[model samples]
Target chain A: MSTPKMNATGEKSPQTRAPLPSQVVKEDEPILVAAAKAGDISAFETLVSRYERKIFRLAQNITQNREDAEDVMQEAFLKAYEHLSGFQGNSRFYTWLVRIAVNQALMKLRKRRPNQVSIDEDVNTGNDLIPREIEDWGPSPEERYKQSELAGILNSTIADLDPPFRIVFQLRDIEELSTEETAEALGLSVPAVKSRLLRARLKLRQKLDRYFRRSENQ
Target chain B: MNCKTLVVELEDYLDEELDSELRTSIEVHLAKCKNCKLIVDTTKKTIQIFCNSEPAPLSEDTRHRLHDALVKKLGRPRA
Candidate 1:
């Protein structure tokens, strides 16, 4: 097999992807927000149209339950509507809405009666923390990428991340927000965001390493 | 920063959030510490792979339900 070319740093030459256009379409969310605040429903609808998907995804990521996510999404938008007049435009509308969604989702989690698992047990007994003989998790990152199953496995591994870490990773990773933006959205300090993101990525790597190791051994 | 400090700052370094002075310190350490370099590389690749996964699309029914609820609560504004 012809090996993929390595760059100056001895890493695969990174493929460039087009940047996502900024999500805020209208230069003036404040204007739309102002109209909505005045009970102009059209302006409110415009605001909703701009942010529904992002709000939905944020809720879903936090709740990890489709039904709960739907409820959180609805409640968040409704709350935003009720308090529309209160918005001072101190932050981007999307950022404010994200806070609302995240708050709603967390409240839902708390109300649901958390599962019986102990926090200490969950942390100490986490899959990666348990010591096991290192298995060669496949040929290496390069070789593993060639496998058809790797993608599916990787997807599942991300799902397996703890919710807090997963949200941070999703915001920083999938959303491509800068660390500062993510911290602001999630109500975390940049350092906290950095640590959570790193821990999340490390956990994911360990999980994939386990999968590849098993595959190689078979 | 030494390997120990660099290891702690691995995430900040990878995220490009480290201040230039601190970044310079870490880069100097990375040049000497192969282990720290590997950790950085692996962490970056892991994040890239995780984030690059296809986003899950929102369900149509969920979208409709949200729209309906928002309309009911706020009502459509006058033209």
Candidate 2:
């Protein structure tokens, strides 16, 4: 396998860049942030380019619609730009920016579905535990073949999750954000983030189990 | 640990959030219980697959449009 090349900053070169595992970049974001706060538009643009795709994907996952995601992306960057000075840098720039994007996405969702209940509200009080008979299917030939199809299945299953669970899964599992960061982004407690993440993962596993089992039968 | 007990602690176990003693106990149980082991292993694989999948990039047109709009609002400054 060809070794992945790195840029001068030791980040994966943009040309061959895969989805970033974490939002953190080692480059001098604080300098760019300072410049942007002082009206350096180019500085702000650099930051935008670095994170726009990530922000867009996060929006897409939450909204479950590309168009709304685009709108949210645009609104998020603009909102962040306008509020540059207010950014205290207490958190990573991407984290702060994500908070803005998530809010925009959630706002759009609310408008589109006015009767929609808050994700925190109306969660079933009962245990509603998942069935325990999860199949192993360890290292089968079908597992190798199923890799390609997994993406589609994963997307559909995730989309089927309730907004609260879906958002947590997107941020925590897909984006690989820390539980604390996920909680901060969604304005939930750390325990809440963990609970949602656990449920989301369990649900996805169940879905995958069923999908693989059916595929094997077929 | 029994299956019910294991089920309650499974997420934490997989996430390595449990205390070392609890983790050891769970591991010991997993070694003996094929069903519970399967659940843990599969759940781990499910998370791994999801995380490893490459996220689709934003369309080029969308990228340019977003950049241009931002540039228009916040005029381009010299690097």
Candidate 3:
């Protein structure tokens, strides 16, 4: 894997990073967690390395700032390693780690946006959830763009969403968290999570329509 | 299921949380409604596209900084 050179002290999130290898032997997370708890520093480092990219992405999507995301990622890993003893293994280590990262990301987001990203929270009345423009994207609409272009489009579209909707979508769809888990992580009700996720999907679909409408010639 | 009802139930239906009877109703409406079908298809694609995309890797300097901080705060990692 060739490294991209840029910045000092440093910060780097490239516009293009190759997709992770499709086939790499992955160790069981529980075993790694057990080893780490037993004072195996290498095992903990392995866990950090395994999840660093995903956690950073989650933070960046939530915070929409590279520098804050980097800080949040570092804090999340440090916090996870600190609290490793209390993890209890009731959930997947990754899930536990994700919860930590989500908390850190949300704090960064709230500090930056100030009352825009709410947990107590903003209410959407569900009155006008119906989408107006419902046009076929044809088959495999996302294939129309190169991966880097598509990534840029995805990040921008998601960034445009309200924080409530964006955070719900990130947890549910991107992070693959369960409804109960998402609600618990964000301190929202299960129904609220579902409704927010629905809005997020619809909002994102509408946003992407212009780019993927089969006639954009993009 | 009219369009409004379909939208109300879309999340549960997509997540397969709805009972089969309601699912059948939504599917029937989707079969007859072109717009609803497109909305559902595109929404599903939106989820897929986001889920499939990979996160960009951290720069070497940042990774090293994180590890260094961890080492200094806790202790050095075994080689």
Model 2 interface CAPRI class: acceptable
Best by lDDT: 3
Docking class for candidate 1? acceptable
Q: What is the lDDT of residue A3 in candidate 1?
A: 23
> In model 1, how large is the Cα lDDT of residue B44?
61
Query: For residues B1-79, what per-residue lDDT tens digits would candidate 3 score against the true structure?
Result: 8999998889877666677899999999999998898888888778777867887778888788788878875688525
Scanning candidate 2 chain A in windows of ten residues, the lowest lDDT window is A1-10
Best-first order by lDDT: 3, 2, 1
Q: Which is superior by lDDT, 1 or 2?
A: 2
lDDT of 1 by residue, A99-193 (tens): 77777877776567477222112232122322234444332453545444765676567778777687777766655555666677666666667
TM-score of chain B of each: 0.65, 0.84, 0.91
User: Which parts of model 1 are misplaced by more than 4 Å?
Assistant: A1-19, A22-28, A115-155, A171-194, A208-218, B45-54, B77-79
The order of the candidates by DockQ, greatest first, is 3, 2, 1
Look at candidate 2 and give me any clashing residue pairs: none
Q: Tell me how each candidate scores on DockQ against the true complex.
A: 0.33, 0.41, 0.44
- Model 2 segments more than 4 A misplaced: A1-24, A125-130, A139-149, A211-218, B77-79
| Candidate 2 per-residue lDDT over residues A1-218, each given as its tens digit | 11213344434233212334453364688899999899878888888878887788789888988899999999999999999899998866877888899889988888888687365654542355446655656553235555547667777888888898888888766665567777777778776776777788778778778766544555
Q: Which 10 consecutive residues of model 1 chain B have the lowest summed lDDT?
A: B48-57
